[model samples]
Target: MIQGDSVTETHQGILKLRVSSLIALLFVAAAASAGCSEKMGSAFAPSAVEGVVGGGQLQFHDADTTSTATQGIASGGKKARWDALPESEKAARKARMAQRKARWDALPESEKAARKARMAQRKSRWDALSESEKATKRAARKQRKARWDALSESEKAAKRAERKTRVRIAK
Candidate 1:
């Protein structure tokens, strides 16, 4: 009877040990999965150290150092760069605009008339707006312009590159 009691005690101890080990293993697995989730989330997050240029070049900026990426870039702004382009490039751009205009010209007369009517309706709606409403809209536009002006040239280039890529992908 004493040996049977001892055997039962030993069995209970082994069962307890197994349960504790299983609980520890489960905790470790949960922590590992949480770590993996964090890594996966960060993989999709935007990187703060790198930017995309207009030419799709990766420009790295160190937080501890000043960025020299825009040093050699033209600094007269977008219009100035357009003005600096060669006549051939200007002509090509003009040709692209002309092509767009040609497409509009080729549209059916009814479609054009409908578009004109829509534009007139839009103008009428704007005209119907109260002075205070117009002022609010103008203020919003100014705020947007100021915010845009506050961005660095590299940031602007990155935004343009991203927009172009998105447009290309959408098309």
Candidate 2:
């Protein structure tokens, strides 16, 4: 009777050890699968540079310098930048814009009319908003832009990947 009791205790101990080892192995496997470089918080966060012209290449400038640059562009007009570009670059840009315009022109008349109507409706709605409401909307836009600018490259990639996945699933 004493020998049987001892055997049972030893078996139970081994079973407990196996269970502990299995749990630890599972934890290690899960961590490995999650990738070492990804931060949990940023995995699904939106990128800070979504609509920027050069994407991740955006440069920061002091307020005065930025305003001056903006003023230069605005005052000089968009034509100035076009004039500064090399002839070959200008030709390529012109070709691209022409292609886009051609595509727009090729759209069905009803579709074009619908788009125009939608734009007019949107403009009317915006115009109807109170000054404070417009200010709030602008502030929200700025906050989103700031948040998008704050994301790291890896986080941005994660967000893009998530967006692609969502789009694919929706389709």
Q: Against the true structure, whose TM-score is highest?
A: 2
- Candidate 2, residues 1-171, lDDT tens digits: the string is 246435576777878767755654554445446542223432222222222222222122332332111211342235567678999998999899999999998998899998899889899999799868987998999999899899999998999889887844320
Q: What is the C-alpha RMSD of each candidate to the true structure, in Å?
A: 30.3, 29.6
Stretches of candidate 2 off by over 4 Å are: 1-96, 152-171
Writing each residue's lDDT as its tens digit, candidate 1 over 1-171 gives 347435576777878767755654564455455553323532222222122222222222233332222322532245577898999999999999999999999998899999899889888988799868987998999999999899999999999899887844320
List TM-score per model, in order: 0.35, 0.40
Global fold similarity of model 1 (TM-score): 0.35
Q: How close is candidate 2 to the true structure, as a TM-score?
A: 0.40
